[model samples]
Target: MKRRLLLVSNSTLHGGGYLQHCQQQIQDFFGKEVKRILFVPYALHDRDAYTKTARDKFKTLGLCLYHMDVEHTVTATVIFISDVLFFSLFPGYEVESVHETPDPVDAVRKAEGIFIGGGNTFRLLKALYDNKLVTEIKKRVLEDGIPYMGSSAGTNVSTISINTTNDMPIVYPPTFAAIGLVPFNINPHYLDPDPNSKHMGETREQRITQYHEELETPSVLGLREGSMLLVEGNKATLLGSTKARLFQRGKQTTEYEPGSDLSFLLTDAQ
Candidate 1:
């Protein structure tokens, strides 16, 4: 069976519509057989709420939820054990939580589908690369047919390289070597309606334009809110209401709507 990679702009558990978007896509694609595993590294503050809410939402969606241990292996083990106990003692499905020890390379490789939660995607990419898990994750997606999904940082990491991010640049260039699952770089949380013009920070479009000019070779996709790219096999198609703008070095700047071909940028420099 072929696997599907679903990357979101952010973890939608905290009221962003991204999570809901992910749910709909999964439902549409996998239907009742959808199984989700959330890789959370930054949801410590509201751990309980996030977990309960995710379980409830998936239940409503008629999907099964599995959570990986984010910190303190014992806590994760406890959650997994408790779930096992519930399944053994009670009557629901078997939902397990595993302690995320020695990184998640093996686990990611084995999963049918994985979701990279929104937070500091750079940080996640850095850790994955440092631990040498990014390569394994990519191998799983490309070679072994595992469906991988990421939001915000997750979405950014799916690109050839992530140049557009709201977080301060803490990771180095080599560490930012993304999964390259898609041909173009992704600028999530993108915006173009900023006519107000008072904010000191560059608008999403402004930042991407600046990056494009500075790079020796650049191919960028500035994706705004509620926008995503659905990549299958070697081809990709833009999804959602917003238009996906492509910027490249040698080609005329063009904006494409959903269902258009993105393979051109793959051969284009940068």
Candidate 2:
């Protein structure tokens, strides 16, 4: 089984609809075999609305989209009058149980493809942890060789860690660790410094540089808008209309144009 990944910098371009800019790339990557995609919409607050948006977009691309909703069920068995008294004493306490229809683990196992949308990275990762889908997703992508697509925050979680994402940490996961689908880290929607602007803030490059100040940090790829990486097996190729910047510790940042081979960054030595 060969690993396949399509990591997009942004789901929508400046003037495009949801996933419109990269529809062809997605279709090509998944090919005709993948007719259905299990979508992960945990990044945003409104799961129903987010799922609808992604489902409609994927429909246009000839793929059916589905999502798993974790359901909670409470079952209270009062075998005796004393049990009711016990419950009254412990106000607001009940025998609660959490379950999901078409279990999330099984959904990933049976998915023809997987697509993770963009939003707050922290929220998405936290949800993944809560649902215990991180390991399942990794196994499906790495072992089963299922095609995995990620956009923005989705792309961030595919790497070694979500530490380089531009999103604020609205929630905390078990750890900053990610799925590690790719050996390195990614900074999606990376913006270049505006030489003419008067704003006094650190540039995207400077922030990634600061990440390198720590020991044992992996290299980070700053993916510009409209850019993506197509990884097949051990080879990773840059795609789309823009170039990407590579940030390495103790080294000058290098720019890679579309069609550049970035397989070198997939090594453990990075």
Off by over 4 Å in 1: 1-3, 10-18, 30-56, 63-103, 170-174, 250-252, 266-270
Model 1 worst lDDT window (10 residues):
90-99
TM-score for all models, in order of appearance = 0.72, 0.85
TM-score of 1: 0.72
User: What TM-score would candidate 2 get against the native?
Assistant: 0.85
Q: What is the lDDT of residue 47 in candidate 1?
A: 35
* lDDT by residue for model 2 (1-270), tens: 378999999988998788877876886797666767788888888877887777776655522211111122332222233334543443221111112235877788787788888999999999888888889999999999999999999999988899999999889789999999988999999999999999988988889988999998999999999999999999999999899999999988899999999999877887
Error of 1 at 186 (Å): 0.6
| Residue runs of model 2 more than 4 Å from their true location after superposition | 62-102
